[model samples]
Target: MSITAQLRDSVRLPGGDALVNGFAFESRGDGPRRALLESGHELEVHDLVEVFAGERAPTAVFPLPWPGWGRGVHSVSPDGSFAVFSGQRAVRAVSVGGETLWEYRHGCWGPEIGHAHTGDEQEVCRGLEHGSCRVSDDGRLVWAHVVVEPEDQDWQECWVVLDARDGRELARLPLDSAASGSHHLSHPDGIHMGLCIGMGQDGILLHWARWDGAKLTSWDLNETMDRILTDVHTGLPGFLTVEHYGADLRLHALDGAVLAEEAPEPADDEDPPCWDYGCGFVDADTVIASTVESDEDPDRARHWLLDARTLEIRGAVAYPTGPVDSCVRPLGDGTWLTYDDTSETLNRWIEAAS
Candidate 1:
């Protein structure tokens, strides 16, 4: 598949802020448009034209009272008629043009700042309210993962899922218990929402929850962290691609079933390389991963292509020069969307000749 490049020129903010909370693309005029929100409470809308042309200045800016917490326009309707943002009190829905269409709030702040208390004191959460809102593939329903604190001020962690149309708690899941701390990674498939729950030092867990219009049915993973990574099918029903990684450093299925667990050759210490972030599949048989290598000479990040089914090294290439940040996603075709530190923006590149 071919790819197009885009950049936001003048909207660049100084570094040292938190990582971007979230970003999304929506239809604007004739092509896809993009919006980026910085951790400093600034929002920028990039028209497809300006983005492709790498325009420096944004069309408009909104200074939200987000307290420098996570900010983003998480979901956009399929027809591009509406969008949703993660706000302080509620999930705000806006027209495609960024006008407020509606606001729905289910929970509120307690007496103390950065604290949320439930009606029965059964659950409580601290810090800024962290949650996500994503439109379903059909664009008819929106799923919101609302982060909340446990009321007893214990170490327990929990999140509430709300119905986006009207604020309603569809389901509540215990993310972490007093003895465990958990974090969620959203890997939403068509009708099933898959989340990766890391159980602190204990390891990671994968759960696949089915979202019926009215409620949710979840299945606990019988597998552990070492057997990480799962094959995910996004657009097509039976087309499977691995989208996440867990413990074994090998490939696994969505239910935590071991697909392959062979270990690769150990990385050479003199090679100045170390695995950094996560690994993503390039196809059913291939995976692309990033790493940082530093020794007596210099330290840098690079991308590695490996055989997902064989655990063999396919290729390794020097990452483009710039900051250390990098994100790689493959298109349905053989090409990939590679974002590096160069433009401080995303760019596209075809896989090198093999």
Candidate 2:
């Protein structure tokens, strides 16, 4: 099968040497579509988050207080009023005017013995780098994974929910596995969130949680599949996309039941099996799976559209340009977005009508 995507829009970024290394798009409750752009060196450099809409200049810019790479996660609130930065030792909320609204600190992320200067903050870590965080749907709570050392126990981490208005801890749940770090996926329901913990060779762990205002409940799906979760389709509740040792893809329910699985179909005997970490639902019933170059095809990447309900390959998607990097992101509206690092531009793609 073959799919074709047209270029819906394209926007060139600001800043000469600045490239959009990471970004998050928040469509404010059907209002304007805003984006948070994180740009700088991959690690150890000045960084900034520029909030913009369409092709307009950034409406707001928040210069991060620290100068490290993915050592932490940062995001702009849905309404574009505030920004949150979760770092190795602190989680801080900053107002539009650059005032620190509130901050929550935790254990370090690297070795306890060494310290490095970040130009702004003293960088230190004991174990893994800090993970990611997401603002709740209503923008009233923040779900974050923070490093913690329990009494008489080895250093570890916990998933903590914070009162977004004041940065107060609302609830905390200890994670049992040895995680290099983790990332969070927020659900539309506001009360539900998914946490994916990467544990190096120990494998990946997926934790699904639901907060009922009074308490937090979670289920570890790793006890069942033990695969690295590549993406979560929040638009399709209970649906998750995961990769098995980079060899195959599986669609699973949040409750750990497998919905469907697929492996690459080699075109010939010498074609190496190819799969990518990038996969997500294009809509409730359609998923976009990307593939890297195989031994037989090194110059081109492939994008496969799958039947979300059955995980069957519906067709290969053709973009106006060619295959993007493996990090293609879904726009949740039957469209997807990709960044061209060389050109420093963002491209949006939509499936052409059948």
Candidate 3:
């Protein structure tokens, strides 16, 4: 029988799009997630628990650097004391009081690195490429995927771990990638981080790294295939990834081992149903996967509940209230999140009682 999904709670987004990491840090793994997003050069932070419980009226907001290209991706510290933004030319950390704590400037992510450098917050760049950054679970280090100034007419990108307090460069690893965009997945140990870089039609690049105080050791996983790392399990020994073309979902060990994998079969009169890039472990034993992209008709889009460790299909997820959207963010703690565009609300979900 198909598993039923029920709404647990929801909060309407204040404005703009909200980025949620419900299970980001190990310390606050069980609590509701805190959310932050850029809205016209302003960073809005939401205590999701308070908003959902009707305990707080207004969430926190802070001023941020002006972005000529785009806001790019950003992450807040575990304690919500500050935030770091991977910008067009720099990685900046801003305090909760709207103060610029520190900024690390790098080669321009704009079209031409040789462009005039304004050295101002209002400086504009002309490029669509972006890299991502995330605060470590311990809140002491910030791991960033950034592009460096090129040499010999060749582009160079690197992953750098910086001091979260002083913005000092602690460690850096060069990456051979032309990323359109990328994101970081934090390991529970707080010392390891997984980076997935999207290289447009060139394919995806997956890199795993460990920072042990003095050095940064990195490894390239699946050197040939394009897999997008989506989520990590708190209780399991592996992380989740979907093929770049959504061909299958895989559970990968940190040492570059495939623990398990699942792919869908083609139905009658239909092309093979490929998985969407969005998927994750809802619990140690259960995973939530989607195939929204495989369906041409939105009404028939689907999500499934599978055995997390074995890649066996338990059943397709059933919603009593309505059909959920295609994208899912699994918290890996028996819960996941979805958003309703019409209502502008972020909805949390769990298995329904029989």
Highest lDDT: which candidate?
Answer: 3
Where model 1 places Cα greater than 4 Å from the true spot, the runs are 1-42, 45-68, 71-73, 97-129, 148-161, 177-189, 197-205, 226-248, 262-265, 270-274, 293-300, 308-311, 318-332, 337-345
How does each model score on TM-score? 0.63, 0.84, 0.92
lDDT of 1 by residue, 1-354 (tens): 211222212233323011221233332122233444443545554443464465656555544334444532355555556656655346677664556666655443213555444554223334333445665556555655443545665333344555655545667676542212222333435566554443345554555566676666776663434222233423222212232332124554555555554332345655434443344455555665554322233344455666666556666644334333454543323333444344455554445443
**Candidates 1 and 2, the one with greater lDDT:** 2
Ranking by lDDT: 3, 2, 1
In model 1, the worst 10-residue window by lDDT is 14-23
How would the candidate models be sorted by TM-score, starting from the highest?
3, 2, 1
Model 2 weakest 10-residue run by lDDT = 42-51
Q: Give one digit per residue, the lDDT tens place, for model 3 in 152-242.
A: 7556899999999978999988888888888888876556788999899989999888888888898998565689988776687667888
Say which prediction, candidate 1 or candidate 2, comes out ahead on TM-score: 2
TM-score of decoy 3: 0.92
Better model by lDDT: candidate 1 vs candidate 3: 3
Using TM-score as the measure, the top candidate is 3
lDDT of 1 at 166: 59
lDDT of 1: 0.45
